[model samples]
Target: MVVTALDLVLAGLVVGFGALVQGAVGFGMALLATPLLALIDPAWVPVPILVPAMVLAIASLLRERGHADWRGVGWAMLGRLPGTFAGVALVVLLSPRAFAAAVGVVVLACVAVSLAPLRVRPTPPLLVTAGLVAGVSGTAAAIGGPPVALLYQSASGPRIRATLAAFFAAGTLLSLAGLGVGGAVTVDGLLHGLLLVPFLAAGFWLSGPARVLIDRGGTRPAVLGLSAAAALLLLGQAVLG
Candidate 1:
């Protein structure tokens, strides 16, 4: 596929903003970027978006490595393995519009759950469950952060960012591998992702200051609001298309 300069600029701006949000909150890059990227170009969904997401995850993890909950990450990874396989299957089976609609539903559901009065703790079992859900969503649609982020909503900002960063860093690799096995990894997708890396770096740099604002009690609202907006946009596009 031939991408024009305009496409690159639009994608860069979307990715940069997504990276900034993810860097500050630890889980919005894919959640915010995937649907928007898909809207820009259907070919950019899972693999291309996953590449920058992986970069952001590694960067966030490095910045807050000491605060991550290793045990929780381990449990999540355990579930991610099987879930990734399922996600790859969906990727192969679904049409682009169908996939977008499905992702929209998942994000909306997650937002509703987060807004509810129920309190969720990141116990071993729940972490595994979140990981499983994340694997499927992240692999298929690249919007896997909400499930895990909800579990850590009440935790300190640094811990939430660090732990999620660790989970995504490994989980994204697993998803990419699954996509490769499923024959969903394309050279065009990779090149597009590489083109967006500099934008991601700029976003990550800006996030250093943004993190302070998030830490001052803006995390949950930001997560929920951005998620809902993206989900709505995705669903609208699917229906209209």
Candidate 2:
């Protein structure tokens, strides 16, 4: 479908909201964008909407993490590559509804994982394991944040955001490359994803202040809100069946 002006506006707003959540917690670009955009125009959701928006968001997101998060990011990237290839391959083979349902299931599982206890802080080995899981799940589903997110739940605020951002940045770049090589990315997807750039920028800017709120100490609300919102998005899609 040629996007109507109203559809553009709706997509823009959805991008903005997703960005806000990213600013708030340092993830959620795909989490927020995928479901909402899918609801709007399933035609656009797969490549047009996700491919470019995520590419831009990841590019902008990684600057701050730099040297600090490299080791973990590297490990995650290693696993993420093959996993993402597997995911895109699945996308090619599966029917559209099957793909959407598969994504929904993975996302919902992430929500449940997030809600569980992280009382025992993560060790390096755990981070490595998370990276492997993230790589596979994200490659297939395009929702890799949960695996890394769970890994970082016990860290300080800055560490959490920076690490996750770095992981996403690298993983997305890999996924984008694989998708492009597979000829999964088309001009239409590029244009649609490009249109959401403003929203992505807005989210980046908004993160500055949200970072303050995050720095103040309490993170229960942020975690709770994201978990609920993500789960709701998935459940809504499943119920629409």
Candidate 3:
């Protein structure tokens, strides 16, 4: 489907809002953007969103490069490759209706997991596990950060942000390539994704000033609220589609 001007404006707003959250919390762009974009048009999931997500990931990583944990990033990448391929297989096999439903389920599950009081140490084995989960979740639904973010919740804020950003950057690229190989994404979809870059950049820019506000408190509630709303929308689409 061709993305109309109205679609571009709506998607830009959604991407901007998501980028705001991500700028504050380090890892929620997909969780916030993917489901809503899917509602706008189910075609917006996976690669369309993944393309912009990678760009955001790179920007975030570069901004916080000093704090990035290279060792952790390395381990995560190890698991992400295989898991990404698995997700590619799913995209190839599943029908659009089924895929939409599954994306809804993933959004809900990720929210549930985020709300749970689970503490995870970012060990190599654990990082690999999180990476694997992230790869599958991200590639399938563009909601991959929860797994890796949960593991890094205990780390210093900057470390958590930078490392997760790095993982996402690498993981998103792999997912995109896999999607390309599977013929699930096309140049048009990627171009559509690129169109949202200006909005994403705007959000990222505003995030710098707004960071202090979210840093104090309310970030968790805000993130959960957005995730829940998006999840509901995605569920509705799945049921009605």
Candidate 4:
């Protein structure tokens, strides 16, 4: 696909906005960028987006380093390895439309889980399970934050943001590796991702002030609303397509 100047500009802006959302909240870059980019070209989905996502996750980790939970991050990564393999298989097997629809369904389900009033302790087993879910979601759709985010919903904001950042840093790398193994990470996607880095940085920088304004209870409502809306939009697009 030809990379027009407009494509670059639009992609940059979209990524920037998504990055801002992620910075203020915890994770939504892929959820916000994927469907929009898919409209530009399907080639811009998982691989291209994952590049900036990894960058964003690292930046988030550094920004909120004090609140990271390394043990939980470790458990998540352990479960993510096999889930990453499963995600690669799904990518190789499913048609584009079918893949999109499946992703939409899973995202919607995750959002539903987030919105529920259920209480979940972050036990090792549950963390591993969340990690597995995140691995598949991250690899397949670049929207892996929900499973882990939902699990940590009742925690402090800093912990939630920082811990998620840590997990995503590792998870995004694994997803990229999985994509590489599947021959999905093309040169064009990488180049496009590089072009959007500046915008992502800008968004992350701007998020600091916004984060201060977000109240304690605001995170849950914001995350849940955005997740549900994004899932609905994804599902609607897949269904209509």
Instruction: Identify the candidate with maximal lDDT.
Output: 1
How should the candidates be ordered by TM-score, best one leading?
4, 1, 3, 2
TM-score of 4: 0.92
Better of 1 and 3 by lDDT: 1
Best by TM-score: 4
RMSD (Cα, Å) for all candidates, in order, is: 2.1, 3.2, 3.1, 1.9
lDDT of 4: 0.82
Candidate 4, 1-241: lDDT as tens digits: 6778898889889999999989988888888898899888777787778889999999999989999989999998988999898888877787656766766676678667665677765779988988987787678777788777877777877888899999999998899888898888888888878888999999999988888765457887776776676667657766787
Separately for all candidates shown, the number of backbone clashes (residues 3 or more apart, or on different chains) is: 0, 4, 0, 0
* 27: Cα error in model 2, Å: 0.7
TM-score per candidate, chains pooled: 0.90, 0.81, 0.83, 0.92
Candidate 2 residues lying further than 4 Å off, grouped into runs, are: 51-63, 66-68, 94-125, 224-232, 235-239
Candidate 3 similarity to native, TM-score: 0.83
Quote the positional error of residue 206 for candidate 1 in Å. 0.5
Model 2, span 145-237: residue lDDT tens? 666665565566677677777777677767767778888778877887788778777767776777778867745446545645654555565
Question: What lDDT is obtained when candidate 1 is compared to the true structure?
Answer: 0.84
Model 3 ranges off by over 4 Å:
94-118, 217-241
Write one digit per residue (lDDT tens) for candidate 1, span 1-241. Answer: 6778998889889999988888888777776676677778877777888888888899999999999999989998888899899888877787757876877787788778878888768888988887887888788778778777777888888998999999999999999899999888888888888899999999999999999999998877876776687678668767987
